[model samples]
Target: MQNSLQGIELFKASVSISHQENCASGTCIDKNLLENYPPELIVGFQLLESVERSGTRRFAIHCGSADNQQHNGLLAWVFNTDLRYSFKDTSSASRSISAKCAMKVFYKHVANVQPLVNPDLGMPSVTSLEELRLPLHIYHCIKTVLEKSTSLLPPSGRKFGEWEIGLLDLESA
Candidate 1:
């Protein structure tokens, strides 16, 4: 059945992110080339929120498909980044902080949701389920966090960052 397939797929697709390394940006690292550093606060808000704060920055993400049980859909976890500011020019102190957190989604019932494109039926390929699920969960999580954190928050805005969502690939080394 679709549920069984989705459950199996969900079990295998578990994914996570981490802060691999960090260093002073003043060094001679190539300016144009941004290293693929591990997810930072912007990309790691949810996983970090679950941890007990420690001296330095380090945390583990332990998310799975509803404790290995089956559900049509469920939220794994989510959190938002602090307001960041970066200057556009050397002369100006004016800045731009990321208005959003980069998100990653771990869907419960994935494979059960058939892809829009099937050779036999020839349905037009719609957006991936991953895309649909990421924004939905992210919005829900952000709204809940902001509402609880501060009473005076701005109205919701468009997604301004990258969200690494979908069935996670864990085997890559």
Candidate 2:
């Protein structure tokens, strides 16, 4: 099947140890304290950069979790893109289309990483070094958005809103 969303071209990705102070003198003296500590998260995207009409579609993700667990959620935004016009003209049809497209990509990113966030065994309260560390801010943002979206629905519709939003499947870490 053909994909409707434009493919993301990853330009860069990196992971760094968090709590540098804990790694004093290059030694993790407190091994238990280091366990599940959040790591620096970085991801860069250059979308459709080769296409003439694509505009400058670029965004970067930089965050670390204070809780030191798996990255439970993602925070994404279109830094620059052909959708610039939509932000300038919110009433235009392009605005809705752009928003939809942007959200699709954001969700796609989350879906791709969901397994890493929540392992197959079961949801864990803390994440390992191998797992992505989701900051509390990002988690709260996603939860708020889901709640607000459900609130906008009719009373009967609200029951299924969280399922449609896929939050139930996320399994908080």
Q: In TM-score terms, which candidate is top? A: 2
lDDT of 2 by residue, 1-173 (tens): 11444553322322233465645586655554433411111211122331224432222222333333444344333232232111233666666433221221222134334444344575663232123233445445444554554454456644432233211111111
The weakest ten consecutive residues by lDDT in model 1 span 164-173
lDDT of 1 by residue, 16-83 (tens): 33323464554544545543332222234333433324321222122222223322333232332233
How do the predictions measure up, each by TM-score? 0.20, 0.25
For candidate 1, list the clashing residue pairs, or say none.
Answer: 46-79, 84-97
Per-residue error (Å), model 1, residue 115: 5.2
Point out the worst 10-residue segment of candidate 2 by lDDT.
164-173
Per-candidate count of clashing residue pairs (backbone under 3 Å): 2, 2
Candidate 2 displacement at residue 85 in angstroms:
19
Off by over 4 Å in 2: 1-133, 161-173
Best candidate (score: lDDT): 2
> In candidate 1, how many clashes are counted?
2
